[model samples]
Target: MPHATIVEEFPKTALSRRTGDVLAAAATGPVCLTDHGKPRFVLMTMAQFERLSGRTDGRTEDWTRDLSPEEQALFLAEIDERMCDI
Candidate 1:
């Protein structure tokens, strides 16, 4: 069975009136905004969105790519030794 998600629900009107409070709640976790007693939207922190969407700073280059051939060989040898230990 899938686990149920516990969300904080707020009516659209209430969310509009208490925007600050709603945003504060979203900072902790997702908040379900409801319209007519049904979920209409989800509010979450920017960090949460980034995490869920696999968003990064666009600096995902491999450090080994810039290394000298000798350095690369040494690094690979160290990694192989470490993996063997595990």
Candidate 2:
């Protein structure tokens, strides 16, 4: 399971007054910007964005080659389960 990181929340108004602080905090992790006490947007560093979005260097490999037979069977089983749900 993936671990969840705690995000700092700031009101939209803080954007103008604390832009520098907000950016500094985002450098460490995600910062949530809220409007009317509800989350409206998230601010994060470009490196964090790229990491979360799966941006990688220009290299590709056949993913299947890395999977063990049992792992492949489990993957296919998951696909079959989802197909049945559909």
Candidate 3:
């Protein structure tokens, strides 16, 4: 189950405050803010933001498509360690 978190939607004038709040909660996902029903701003967690930034040490490999339990555990352990360093 996912943890309950607060995502506030504020008007353009209050974008700065919303951004600050979202950055403070950087371990969670993004808090989406909109303008006239269109996505205007996305406040992402540090991890998410870093992934979006795209300058990462991540590698692409075919092994991710399908994995045995042991392979998955090792892969996830590596990812978790990487997450901590990030």
Best by lDDT: 2
| Candidate 2 global lDDT | 0.63
lDDT of 3 at 63: 47
1 or 2, which is superior by TM-score? 2
Please state every model's RMSD to the true fold in angstroms.
Answer: 17.1, 14.9, 9.8
Question: How many clashes show up per model?
Answer: 0, 0, 0
After aligning candidate 3 to the native by TM-score, how far in Å is the CA of 44 from where it should be?
2.1
**Candidate lDDT (C-alpha), each:** 0.61, 0.63, 0.51
lDDT of 1 by residue, 1-86 (tens): 21224357888787769997786566555688889999898876544455456673423226467877556545544544475589
For residues 1-86, what per-residue lDDT tens digits would candidate 2 score against the true structure? 22225368899899999987786666556788999999999886544455467773412214335777455434444543475589
Candidate 2 local Cα displacement, residue 25, angstroms? 0.7
Flag the better candidate by lDDT, 2 or 3: 2
lDDT score, candidate 2, position 70: 50
Superposed Cα deviation of residue 36, candidate 2 (Å): 0.6
lDDT of 3 by residue, 1-86 (tens): 22323355545555676655554443344566667776687665433444567644444234444876445435644665587798
